[model samples]
Target: MSLAPRAVLVHRTTEYEELLARHGTAGQAAFFLTSRGRDLEPVAARHARARRTLAAVEAAVPLHWRRARVERADLDRFLFGPEDVVVVVGADGLVANTAKYLTGQPVVGVDPEPGRGLGVLVRHRPADTARLLTAAVRPDAAFDELTMVEAVADDTQRIRALNEIYLGAPGHQTARYRLATATRPDPAAPEESQASSGVLVGTGTGATGWLRSLWRERSGPPALPAPTDPRLLWFVREAWPSPTTNTTLVQGALTNGDHLRLVVESDRLVAFGDGVETDALELTWGQTIRVGLADLRLRLLV
Candidate 1:
């Protein structure tokens, strides 16, 4: 007998669960929400709906196929094999976070909510679980390959990101770094040492996320990449001009063969991808880091 294909269901704690955890008691949670003029009914309803969705997914799964459930908090420690089919039952961010850890697994993004913004990634509803699962593990499953970004440090450490990678101080304080790029328009220009809030390197799939906010905040926003575009966009936040620091290399696009390098001029800097700080790369002064498009692509089941 052959082993059945495994399906991994990824989810996060519901709002009600979070409230109770924070308050330590149902009464306290209710009191806290009431104080904010919110009712617990909405949270309860959402939790109930999520449970129903999970149950439906469990029922839809074939007996021959192995099924596993993972919480968002444990995603970093979870081990995923290449043969597994990933199903995320959460918001859009959860899908992005899950994508980073996967190399070639087909991901089915399930939106717990029915008619909201129609999540860009989590487009499927809970009701479609059975049908999507059946198609996901098929040899000819229709999927879209989304681009991902990567950050490589001088210490030979590397992190891949499906959404965007953030490089800077742990807090909101200014980050001082020497920014250099292989694709700089002015080849003669020396590497620039600059002080800024931070830098964001993201792929086309991430354009609608953190990159979009940065684009919108600009005086003249540039066109961003589509979900499957094989390009990357990077920008420095609040680059400060000083006698020693320059801000000329604040924003640019990176193609397949291009790379962006940065030397940690500050005391400390950190690089995190998909907003998962637990899985972060730490950089001290005198360290150089490179950010670019990763060769691996996220195969998202559309």
Candidate 2:
């Protein structure tokens, strides 16, 4: 028989908690904030609200259902089961941060501070958890299959993100690579060698974030995709033109089966997702990587 579905509560360390940890005392934390021309009351209040909201969500879980709690820092090491019902109790970015580690688990995004957030992903309040949890396990439960992006290295190392995947140097230096795409209609077009900051591939959901800033600067066709659109958008950040390297293939759109291929020309290149640089795939010279739409979609409960 199948085991009962687990309610996995995901959260991040609050700023107040971090301050207290750093200062070793609440009074010292407040003093440090005061010295910086900021008040501690607001931070403490937000922390209190977060704790209350987390408690409420935990209390709402069905007593008999298996439950687990994980912090954002520990997500990389945490094991998520197939039958897990993930509940992210923080900002919308927290949901994005947690998305990559999960497979097809249904996620319920709960806004701890409702009015302050954009409410795009974290649409529900703490009180809605119990009802949402019940609906999430049903056969006809409604969910939005948010598209995600992935980068796969030739050695089988890979990473996925709900927002975007960044492949480039780990620092402020330029990254050198040969770029090509398999989806281009023009078969005669040749691949280009590039030396620049890096390459970024993002989904429609990501268009509102990093991709939006880049999209706004350029005026052209192939509009950004919708949140659920299967298409992806890619851009080469500050591609440097040289005698040998060209910037002809800077930006484009990708379809379902399309992928962007890159052969590393530098000593090292890193591929990371959702701005988490710590957990990334490292590539050496001559190693190839492909960026494309991932098979894993984020099953976000609406």
Candidate 3:
């Protein structure tokens, strides 16, 4: 017999909870914020809303459907089953963060504090949970397939992100690497050695975040891709020009078959996706990685 559909509710620790944990009590937490000229009432209210949202979503799950709850910090260790229907409750970033761990499961993003967020990914509210959960379990349900980017190291370490990926030093120092692209029509072009802040490769869903700020700073020809576009954009941040390095190749787009290749020249470099640094791939000197569109897309329930 086939397994019953499962609902996996995902959430993160709230600011109020963090404050209480650090200060040891709600009164102390309020005092700490008050001393800093900040109000704790808003934080506490938001936390209450988040808790209520989670409870409503959980209650909406059918009793016959298996269910599980996962905190954002534990996503890296969570094992997602093939029949899982993911429900992420929080800001839009939480959806992006959860997208990296999933395969093709239909995801329903629920916003706890609605107007405060961008409302791009977390587009649903707590009241919509029961209906959305029913739709999500249907094999014929409609969903938007959002693009994702992936970086695969030659050693086989790979990472995927729904928003964008960052490759750079783990510290404040510059990242040293040799950059090249396979999409160039002229195959004989030489790779450039770069010494800069880092490299950023993002998807269309990412265009609303860090990629949008970069796009606004320049007059561009290749426009940013749509949320479901199969293309990706790469930018080399603060590419410095020196005797040994060049800044000519700073930005470009990667289509379906295109890839950006980076060979580590520094002693150590790190590659992280969706701003999750703890779950990242560390590369040493001479390691090579190729960044491109991931085969797996985020099936976001509309």
Cα deviation of 50, candidate 1, in Å: 0.8
Q: How close is candidate 1 to the true structure, as a TM-score?
A: 0.94
- lDDT per residue for candidate 3 within 1-302, as digits (tens), equals 99999999999999999999899999999999999999999999989988988998999998999999999999989999999999999899999989999999999999888799788999998998999999988769999999999999999999999999999999747999999964843466568999999999999999988988877775673699998999999988888999999998888899987899999999999999988888999999999999999999999999
Assess candidate 2 and give its TM-score to the true structure. 0.97
Q: Report the lDDT tens digits of candidate 1 across residue range 113-214.
A: 867655888889877888998998878999999899999998999999988999999885899998986474455645789899999998888887789889
Better of 1 and 2 by TM-score: 2
User: What C-alpha lDDT does candidate 1 achieve relative to the native structure?
Assistant: 0.86
Whole-model Cα lDDT of every candidate shown, in order: 0.86, 0.92, 0.92
TM-score of each: 0.94, 0.97, 0.97
Give the 10-residue window scoring lowest on summed lDDT in candidate 2. Answer: 181-190
Ranking by TM-score: 2, 3, 1
Inter-residue clash pairs, candidate 2: none
Give the residue spans of candidate 2 off by over 4 A: 182-189
User: In lDDT terms, how accurate is model 2?
Assistant: 0.92
Model 3 TM-score, 2 decimals: 0.97
Candidate 2: give its CA RMSD in angstroms: 1.4
Ranking by lDDT: 2, 3, 1
